[model samples]
Target: MTYELYYWSGIQGRGEYVRLALEAAGAPYRDVAREDGDRVLSAFGKGIETPSFAPPFLKDGAVVVGQVAAILLYLGDRLELAPKDERLRLWTHQIQLTIADFVVEGHDVHHPIGAGQYYEDQKPEALRRAEEFRNERVPKFLDWFETILERNPAGPDHLVGDRLTYADLSLFQVMSGLSYAFPRLMERLYGDYPKIAAVSAAVAKHPPIAAYLKSDRRLAPNEEDIFRHYPELDP
Candidate 1:
């Protein structure tokens, strides 16, 4: 059965990770939000039977799952984007969860006080949060990945071993998200971490990814979701 993905229609937001992975794997799936305009809100208004904690949900056959990490975990296993070895599989999940945490922190830098509140309303607090994220969190996260890549005996052709995995794709998306939201800050930091940049650029140039990126369906970055550009938040 064909898989179905649901998320906000416009910006790629959190959903892009799943989209990029699916696209790269050449898997058959429906981006439901993009397929039917207004469908995202209409379905959302109807509400989930258990109440959706958040969006970027997926439906495959009888199973329905939400949360970006959960969706990717499911897809990674089924799409062969994850390792078959138990240890490596768990490690991949661990990294993916870490990436999820990083994404949440990035979002919080913009909406430090409240996700429900506007950025303008929380500008002062947001500025303080963004500064910390820029100077501290950004380097730490990048360094963590840098360490992982450096230790990989497989020579860093990808995040895990020599093949592409969901974690690498997610990392690529995170790198892109940060660059879009914090261009100047990334410019200052990314230069120091060559492996991270190389992997991100390689993911973009991957054949299937290159085609999907060229397609109109690939949404552009905007002021929403985990990443948002605020000039004042940058140097």
Candidate 2:
């Protein structure tokens, strides 16, 4: 069965995480909103039995899964992107949740005051937040991922197990977004986290993921997206 994904058009946003997993697994899925913009609003307006709080929801037959981590968890088992061992599987989910937290923090750097308010309106606050995020939070999150890779009993090639998992894919996306959002900060800090860098490189080289990155389906990062790059913000 072809999976149906509902997310806002244009920006990659949180939807990209789910897209990366589906692409890595070579799953056949339809980007519903991309095909029909109105479909997202229609589905969201008319509530399903299990309505999602927002976009980036997935439709598989009758089952509707919401939230990036939840969607990946649901897809991981079926797509073989998750580990078979229950303990390792939960560990992978934990990693994805942490990544989700990192994404939110990264976004908050630009919109520190409120999501509804414009970045220009909160420029002063955003500048302060961005400095803290760049100096403290970025290294903190990257350090944890580096330790996870260094401690993985299997190897450092992947995040969870010897084989590829959704956690690794999600990490790659996070790294990519971070690099785009804060090229200067990452250029200086990324080298220190060689294991995290290795995972990002490996995921980019993965055949399916490589193809997806090159395809038109992959949207470029922009100021409007969660990972926005402002010259002042980065400086």
Candidate 3:
């Protein structure tokens, strides 16, 4: 049976994380909102005993899962995007959770005041927030990823085991989003994080992902998305 992925129609937000894993695994899935459009807003406050609390939730048969990491966790074993060893599988989930933290930080740069306010409304605070993100947070997050890749006994080719896991695809998505959101900053810092750069490059070159990127299915990052770029903030 094909899986159902529910997320906003436009913008490659958190949904891209799950999409990458599904694409790499060659899993059949329907991007629910993209097809019917109304299902997303309709899904809210309706259906299932437990509320998703947000979009980017996945539905497989009677099972419904939300949160990027949790959805990926549920899909990992089924899609072969996790290691057989339980410890490594949990480790991958840990990395993915950290990635989620990093993603929130990225989003806050533009919405420092609140998600309810416009970036223009929070421009001053966003500038301050972005300063910390660009200087302190980006390096901190990238450094951790570099260290994890180096420490992986299997090799730097993957995050958890020798094979590509949802964590790896998530990392690649982060790198891609970060690059689009901070091109100048990444160009300056990419040299210091060779392992992360290598992983991003390799993930991009993977046949399934490469084709997905070329296909109409892949949504482009934009101002409406989490990783929005304001030129002043980029500097």
Candidate 4:
């Protein structure tokens, strides 16, 4: 069955992580919202017995899953983007959860007051938050990921085992987002996290991923998306 993915049109946002896993694995799926954007709102807390709180939900037959991490976890196992061993699978899930946390924190740097409020209204708070995020949280998270890659018994090429996993793909997306959102900071710090950069490069160059990135299926990053570049905030 071709999976139907529900997310806002014109931006990757959280849905991009799910899209990455699907594209990497060459799974059959459709961006439902991209086709008929208004159609996506129909699933928002209404039609399905288990309603999604927001977009980026997956409908694979009767199994409807929301949340980027949960959707990726479900797809990881089914798409063979995870290790067969239960332990490794759980480890991948753990990593994905951490990535989700990192994403939220990164987003809050711009919208420090509230997600609903305009960034302009909270520009002062955003500046402070962005400072902390760039100085403290950025290094902390990247360092943790770097350590994970360094200590992986298999190698630094992949986040888990010898093969690529959904976590690895997600990490790649995270790195790319960071770079886009904070190019100046990333340009200075990315060298400090060589393994993470290597993994990001590998994911970008992966045959299927590379193709999807070039195709119209891929949505380019924009200020409206999860990773927004603000010269003042980032600097």
Candidate 5:
């Protein structure tokens, strides 16, 4: 049976991680929310015993899993998209978590003061937060990943080994999300991180992902998710 993915419709949000892995693996899965408008709310209302305390949950046969990273791990193992070595698998998870942290920060840039509030209402606070994100956090995080690539003896084909892994896909999603949200800032800031740029481009150019990019199912980035665009947030 094909796996079922439940997440908010329209925006990719956290759901895209699962989507990317499934797509790249060429695995069959149903995007439940996209199929039904109320699917996400219905799943939440049903009080499903979610593993990660969030949406973007996955249902694989009888097992239910949540959290983007965990979902990727589950899918990676089942689909053979993850590294086979134990050490490499752990490293992939570590990178996935770091990407998750970056995602949370991206969400905070617009909702720095309050996620429940709007960009119009939190403009002043968002400006301050975005400045910090653009000037400090972005470079720091990118530099850390760049160092990982430099330290890796594998020549950067994968975050862990020579094959495509979930972490590489997540990194691609991060780059795509950031570019959609802050095109100018990304262009300006990403210049220093060659490894990141290479990974992003490579993942996008991958056969499965490249085809997905050309498909209609791929949702466009918008204001609803973590990587939101705000003109005021740009420097």
Candidate 6:
């Protein structure tokens, strides 16, 4: 059965994380909203037995899963994108959660005062937030990923174990978004996190992921997305 994924059409946002995992696994899925924008709105308005608070939800036959991490958790076993060992699987989920936190912080940099407020209205606050985010938070998050990769008993090729998992895929998406959002900042700091960089490179080269990246399905990062590139903010 082909999975149905509901997310906004034009932006990658958090939905891209789930997309990466599905693509990496070569799973058959339809990006529902891309084909029918109204479907997502209907899902939100009409609601389901188990409604997701927002888009980026998945429908698998009878089951509906919400949240990027939760959707990956549900798909991990089925797609063989998670560890078989219970402990390691949980570890993978933990890593995804951390990545989710990083994503939120990245988004907040542009809308520090409030998400509802335009970036122009909050430029002063965004500048301040971006400074700390670039100088401190980015490094801290990347450093932790580097440490995890170095400490992984299996190898540095992947995050949770010797094999690929959703965590690695999610990390790749995070790194890609960061580079797009803060190219200068990442260019300056990325070298220090070689392991994190390696993971991103590996994921990009993965046959399926590479194809997806080149495909029209992959949306380019834009100012409207969570990872926005404001030159002044980057500087």
Clashes of 5: 0
Cα RMSD to the true fold for all candidates: 1.8, 1.0, 1.0, 1.0, 1.5, 1.1
lDDT of 1 by residue, 1-235 (tens): 7888888888788889899889999999988877776467456536456435777888887678888888888998889999988888888888999998999898999999998889999999999998899989989999999999888888876778788899999999999888888999988887888998888889999999999989998888888667998889987
Compute each candidate's TM-score over C-alphas: 0.94, 0.98, 0.98, 0.97, 0.95, 0.97
Candidate 2 C-alpha lDDT tens digits along 1-235 = 9999888888899999999989998899999989988466465647568888887899999899999999999999999999999999999999999999999999999999999999999999999999899999999999999998999999899998899999999999999999999999999897799999998999999999999999999998988899988989888
Looking at candidate 5, the ten consecutive residues that score lowest on lDDT are: 43-52
Clashing pairs in 3: none
Instruction: Compute the lDDT of residue 1 as modeled in candidate 4.
Output: 88
How much is the lDDT of residue 56 in candidate 3? 84
TM-score of 3: 0.98
Estimate the TM-score for candidate 6: 0.97
Return whichever of 3 and 5 wins on TM-score: 3
- Which segments of model 4 are wrong by more than 4 Å? none
Each candidate's number of clashing pairs is 0, 0, 0, 0, 0, 0
Which residue pairs in candidate 4 have backbone atoms (N, alpha carbon, C) closer than 3 angstroms, thus clashing? none
Report the error of model 1 at residue 136, Å.
0.7
Task: Give the lowest summed-lDDT range of ten residues in model 1.
Answer: 42-51
As a whole number from 0 to 100, the lDDT of residue 42 in candidate 6 is: 62
**What pairs collide in candidate 5?**
none
> lDDT by residue for model 5 over 93-173, one digit each (tens)?
989999999999999888887877778898888888888988899889888888887787888666778888899999899
lDDT of 4 at 157: 96
Tens digit of per-residue lDDT, candidate 6, span 45-73? 37567888877889899898899999999
**lDDT at 130, model 3:** 91
Residue pairs in candidate 6 whose N, alpha carbon or C atoms collide under 3 angstroms: none
Error of 1 at 155 (Å): 2.0
Q: Candidate 1 — which residues are off by over 4 angstroms? A: 38-51
